[model samples]
Target: MQLSCPLPKFDFDVITLGHGSGGLLTHRLLQKGVFDILGNEFLGQQHDGASFHMDGKLAFSTDSFVVHPIFFPGGSIGDLAINGTVNDLAMCGAQPQYLSLSFILEEGLKTDEFSQILADIKTAADKAGVKIVTGDTKVVEKGKGDKLFINTSGIGTVHPGAAIHHQHIRPGDRVIISGNIATHGMAIMSVREGLEFETSIISDTVALNHTVYTLVNRFGKGIKFLRDPTRGGVASVLNEVAELTELGVDLVQSRVPVEEQVEAACEMLGLDPLYVANEGIFLAIVSEDIAAPFLQALKEDELGVNAAEIGVVSVNHPRKVIMESRIGGSRVVSYLTGEQLPRIC
Candidate 1:
């Protein structure tokens, strides 16, 4: 006898506003779409900000977020914009201090929504210990803009005895990740059209100055380079570092932390988590001798409890990133060829 099987049914076929409602729809979008494309340590944990310590110097960084729908689970454009910039500075081993905000507002956007966004900005700044000292606001004629757009620039002071740069990477150095991967991208994708999930996935958007400070305080000059995998996730970051230093980065696939739901979503959607965007996580390359202590210190922090040494620098395969799969095979991890998800910030 032959048995009949039922096919899976989907509730929607395309994107919808409900996807951006910071609920179930949002989680599905991220898990199936964004996380599948870009997954890395900083993007996975779904935390508020990365916290660490630094010596004392000057560091600067900038970022822009154009997430559609503007608002979603756990945060909005206001806080995302601020945290994005602050985290960039922290990736340089700096403590964020000030920021500049610029907005492109749609003419028909509700004043109430704008006010709420402003409140979110203030709240995020207060939590990160940074100030929005200057900003500009512009309104575009209706239909010319997406309800709202944000761009932020941030500046911070680097710890005095700290030195972090891409050139500092050396063979035998260990690669340390702050936490899990694919949370922010999954959070944003969960709100995209058609795709939907049962659980709510929130954006892991937060500053990392404090967390960075902690690492720098404990590790000092043993730390080499720091970068928050945002646009291209860990693959892009590792590739860039490899190209910059003419070194290879060998990563252990099983050692890289990824949430089960996120992994399932990515597999279903044919996405590579290593290429996803992350908002609240970072990577640190430290001397092999200090890698153990650094890993231990990271585990003690709330934001980095899942931290791991996923890889190490290699002298072979210059300017390449190679991943050792769980099945014992190796593959080259290249830079993202195109925009996996535009406006992912």
Candidate 2:
């Protein structure tokens, strides 16, 4: 017999302790709401754990989102959760396939808001061409947990011909930034501090897996390294790469793409855009032979329209990052010692 139970109206529009009780209310939530919205073959199996097949190397990554202000100028936590996890896999030269999500929801969260977040998650997953194969939700006491926190684990298969790892980096490799930097950090700061700019600074929170996939499909192993500069922005990524490869990266201030307003904000706030965070930006270390064609390919995409060859790997200062200022001054670029932006995904 087919199950025909209709969704029942809850007296409270907000979540409560019963939502996590794993009883009638929990079943009602899964059957009536979540299942209908996110059902797929793997999820429909309804097993305690999901099972899937893989042929070659498997790439797995997981990240938790605890950004302040669940909703931001350009994106919500939901989109960040999905895109961030997907980007992690993409950095490994993998094609993201399946995801598992776990929600830590506060007791007082409104059902409507929860539904909106679910909608956002669905949209992001669809755009990335990945499926949410499994998930779990738990409601915490009102004040104990923030409005919501999300943990997403992703699984993908690395492209056969792709050898994207830091070990592959070498001296003379060219460095490229996918697009402009510092937009995401400035966007968050603008909203939190109520600072208005001549133009709105929206977060650069987009999925980069497809673009990476296309690039790898074209260049394969020629792309030496891939990284998404998230927490510590461009400076940290360069420093880490330099240390790992024992090479120096020389960046030109004029070659890097920074939005005009972002530069102004950084100057006004005494913050260096290089140390700021980015959500939708990535850096590639490409061998000299393929750098020209790879750079052109990156510019062809809307997300990478402003792509620029910002720097090149050098042996002058081993394991360091140096920048050439627009005025022709060279200086060491240190990683910001303290937290520039806290709780940023």
Candidate 3:
């Protein structure tokens, strides 16, 4: 029964089942596809997990990425898992150290896709200078699970002089965004349905630990609150901060950055950019006196090139978010009542 079937030519761009076989195909995929784009010092070693050193108090955080479609324009779930956890620790002003990854794979999933995701995770961790020290994997029956889901836990050490928390926020503090908003959410939306536009938009997913580290080292206690708006976007994060600190937030429409492509997509879809997810962005509350210097430092970093003072903490209307419209009218930016887009990560 030795019937031979010829291998098909690899003309397709999409993933195939054989890629995850842990064999030659998997190795080649990692070498020519994933690693070639994201090669870094920490990832070049190609160990199960990365190892590094630290010097300060320890901080830990974990997050899971279940963004539908897994693959997006500028990043994938693998990097998302790593960056999300590292950013969580970074929000607390910590230097990310180690990571733990767990994967849930659906039955009949493509091995190539899974291998690519794993390679992405490694590349992301390496770029952030963190290690994936431990991990787990599981299989679920088809239809019961999405193609794949990834959970990542991270630990880092807090710098000696760094101290940031919601409670530290006070009226008159300035709010600065690391960069443009809604790029990640819109990028996902564009790819999910093959929506085309005049210009291309890419996801903003990335690790913010190093940028945060630089800010903390220079600004120290002046940096009051740090938050990465993920699921509910900047509006949700701001509302949370207002509730936590019992302060009101007022953001100017003109100051908040939004890409034209994202704006057009949101308008066409009747979606608001404020409620979209962002990966490579953050919100920083700092003393008004140090705002200029902080903004200067942030602009130096690639991720913070578009950093801007979008709003300020206010004492009036505690626990509320008010936005001054571009037309000079005031409106309340409330929390999302229902999920606008699901599985957006």
Output candidate 2 Cα RMSD: 4.3
Tens-digit per-residue lDDT, 239-318, candidate 1: 99999999999999999988887777677667899998788889899999999989998999889988999999999999
Q: Tens-digit lDDT track for model 3 on 1-345?
A: 011222222323544444556676556645665455444565567677776776658898878789987987888888789999999999989998878777777767665566567667766777899866655556667787888888988888898888798878889999999999999999888877555454488899999999899899999999998989988999999999888999999999999999988999999989999999999999999999999999999999998999999999999999999999999999999897799778888
What's the ranking of the predictions by lDDT, best on top? Answer: 2, 3, 1
Better of 1 and 3 by lDDT: 3
Q: State residue 260's C-alpha deviation in candidate 3, in Å.
A: 1.0
Candidate 2, residues 1-345, lDDT tens digits: the string is 011233233345888878888888877777777777677888888777799888999899999999777777788888899999999999999999999999988999987666667777877899899999998889899999989999999999999989998888888999999999999888878766455455578889989999999999999999999999999999999999988888899999999999998998888888899988899989999999999999999999888999999999998899999999999999999777989788877
Off by over 4 Å in 2: 1-12, 193-199
Taken over the whole model, the C-alpha lDDT of each candidate is 0.77, 0.87, 0.83
Worst 10 residues of 1 by lDDT: 1-10
Q: Relative to the unseen true structure, what is the C-alpha lDDT of residue 217 in candidate 1, on a scale of 0 to 100? A: 74
lDDT of 3: 0.83
Better of 1 and 2 by lDDT: 2
List candidate 3 stretches off by more than 4 Å. 1-56, 194-199
Error of 2 at 213 (Å): 0.6
Candidate 2 has its poorest 10 consecutive residues by lDDT at: 1-10
